[model samples]
Target: TVESRAIGPNMTACHHSYGRPDLLVYCCPPGFEKSVPFVDFELPEPPSPVKVRRPAHLLDESFIVKYNKALSIMKSLPYDDPRSFARQAELHCQFCTGAYEQLNYSDTPVNIHRTWLFFPWHRMMIYFHERILGSLIGDDSFALPFWAWDIPESMPMPDYYVDENSAFFHTERDFSHFPPRVADLDYTTDQNHPHRSNDEQIDVNLKFMYTQMVSGARKTELFMGCTYRANDGYCDTTGTVEHAPHNTLHTWLGSSLNPGREDMGKFYSAAKDPIFYAHHSNIDRLWEAWRKINNRRLDITDPDWLDSFFFFYDENLKLVKIKVRDVLDITKLGYSFEEVDHPWLNHRP
Candidate 1:
């Protein structure tokens, strides 16, 4: 598994690119070494008051204030600090981009995207991120707001993030794609694509969400993505949700004028934007929603997947090694999404 290979001695940074092979995107953390021994992850006793992640658009003023303050604190920390916002964003880059390679497998990059590792890997990433934010604000129950793009009324970029003074704001985002401008879930980079009215776009988005979550994803592999191993090369067969609304929203929010769509469009820079977490929070919520949709729709029961692990710096600055099985239940990790109307639940296209 990638975990065993990654923890090996002599682990060095791997050179790689995002879209174009020539356009190298270097995101490896400075002063990284394999000398720090990783402590095995242990599931915590269920949180006393499980943090409930709310929709970004529906977040109350007090909650938004707290959220902004937490992010501000995170951003103020020195870049070298593992719990700093800078390093948190770089963590995503290191994994999604080819910044690390399988220890014994020569030149074989370890990427969590486009494979079964996608959901579980990201779930763990944000779990720690949320913890860091809550810790910064001195509130253990603080939760991240999710960009509820799947719903009709909450479709556009949340207004809280649009505030220039808020910590959620990212200047690199597409100004034209700001709030009130309904998002195109099927959005592509093609400039010539026709535009739709707000009502029309919302209608289309609901249908797209329905297809990705329901009829299109019936099996565990189809919903979560294909199997990926430590020695395997890139596995491009992304799950239905990851391919459409997940990937499309990234492109939709990113600045199209920028070279590689800095901030959100590219994996290397996606988490740099505060909205990235909210967006992924929704993706993570969809994973849970998908599971409840059908009794047969379940997580992959393969040992390789259950045993696969990733390293993360917790809110306490402890370098902990977490396994895939550890994050299977959000309640165990001390968080859950707020209940909301799933308009796309029955809107089968």
Candidate 2:
């Protein structure tokens, strides 16, 4: 059976079709970096302008009603609602199609900048989507949560995520104990057939980011994973963990996908999937936690970093573009979350 399991909210690896046993194992690009041992990132809390109440996980039964309402509208949608899923899909189609056409297809090695921008842009996109969910659930305090991947053992899998009956619970699948390489791989250009194995490789890149450790280019590979060693379509087969890299549904979407397998931190092709918001929310939560661990990591403080963007839709199904600057002030959007009591902050290893 195929394991089309989800990673974290809205994102799942669809690796069953390639004759691979699981999507969990991906091939390494050239110059594969050592895997960083998964470590629990903990830190003192950072003060926020907004009152940080309990986390979103502790929301009550009523929240589920709103969650389902918003989610249903996002996917299947309501019969009377003007802003339905069909409208959203239609708008995206016109926008993406028009955008793709304006570019020069005649150029060799034509890459889509839109594809590159999709992940971060979608981050904000889903942020709003979840907000609608929160509003519908009647708890402005809600935020879509994520699946914590850095923990060492028994990380959750898809089988346990969705249960129409249950009120709230997480799945099971530990990243730390994930399968390692089954046999020695011949690090050659001809190495093609891909499979996965489990090992005890320690990741040096994560150590650098979470801890104040130092790592060089090898650290890059460590940050990404095995996909670094495998030959990317690009000849620059330098091995290192990459971020915002691969598009899981690029073939299905027939669009250009990013090349990454690093921390799943930055951008990912999986965001197009409806659950992208939840996976990223977990990622964003970790970012919040990391900021507390180390002050420097706080929300995009870079001057020229282009950290913000916008997303909206029009009546005629045209994709509306928003800038990062406008939405940065989340408070002005007229929403606040009621603190969660038992957030999955991963206090226990």
Total backbone collisions for each predicted model: 0, 59
Q: TM-score for candidate 2, please give it.
A: 0.43
Score residue 259 of candidate 2 by CA lDDT. Answer: 26
Model 2 Cα lDDT, one tens digit per residue, 290-331: 334444332343322232232343222233444434344435
Candidate lDDT (C-alpha), each: 0.84, 0.31
* Cα misplacement distance, residue 216 of candidate 2 (Å): 7.6
Give lDDT tens digits, candidate 1, residues 216-294: 9988878899877667667668999999998888888889788877779888888999999999899999999998887
RMSDs, each prediction? Answer: 2.5, 15.2
TM-score of 1: 0.94
Off-target runs (Cα >4 Å) in candidate 1 are 1-20
Off by over 4 Å in 2: 1-62, 78-120, 137-139, 152-154, 158-160, 164-274, 289-294, 297-309, 314-321, 327-349
